[model samples]
Target: MEVFVARSHPVDTHVGNRLRQRRALLGMSQTDLGNAVGLTFQQVQKYERGFNRISSSRLFEFSKVLDVPVEHFFDGMGATAVAAKRKPGRPRAPEKPADSDLNTKRETLELVRAYYKIRSKSLREKTRDLIIALARD
Candidate 1:
């Protein structure tokens, strides 16, 4: 079956390219990644080709499965490191957060699973409010 082409952002293209590059860097074949993700090789091909949309759940799964940070897939876009560092209205030098404390795929995947278990919408909202409040201070 032929995959359909839809309108895409430059960032989408960048993300797909990054996925393919990282797979190649790890010496993983499309079939291999497909097996890891319980997909057919053709499906993996479609994703890498940017003909299919990868859902956020799949993206999170991929990050853990690949043992990379979620941002690693979008690490170097048109935005430079310095650009990513600067948020509006923040005059101080951007403090870089350390990379993942959990190194292995197992650890990363476990953390992701736990994160999805939070049950309270109010808790999520409060957490978000607190984070934004803290960041602004």
Candidate 2:
């Protein structure tokens, strides 16, 4: 007889990635998020790693504490990941999207945090232009 063991859903992974990104962007530690959401840091770590699924109510609470809309967690998830949430068994691996590169990189996140910290809009724009020009070279 075959035993059916459930694996982590792709949507769950995507949500976790979003959660981690948002938390990092805010410079919040796992302990900080845990305290805000009434959970342990280990629980927050599990959620961020997609080792456990997040309940809707719990997700809503996280959204409130993170200062983001509930939909934010679902952002950038592909159709395959969304569909996997509705189906029962293990899902097929998804195709990698080109733009997903930046999203998965620590450097990109750090750059984003630093970019937002720039107080002057003109300076930010100039910096953006410089980066674009550098990227073309």
TM-score of each: 0.51, 0.83
| Candidate 2 weakest ten by summed lDDT | 90-99
- lDDT digits (tens) for residues 1-137 of candidate 1: 65543433445545666676667555578898889988988987777665676887787777787789889877766653334432344344332222221322344444444445568878766766776799799
What would you estimate as the lDDT of candidate 2? 0.83
> Which pairs, if any, clash in model 1?
none
lDDT of 2 by residue, 10-71 (tens): 77878888888889888899999999989999999889877799999999999999899999
Clash number for candidate 1: 0
The list of candidate 1 runs beyond 4 A from truth reads 1-5, 79-137
Best by lDDT: 2
For model 2, the stretches where C-alpha displacement exceeds 4 angstroms are 1-5, 85-91, 94-100
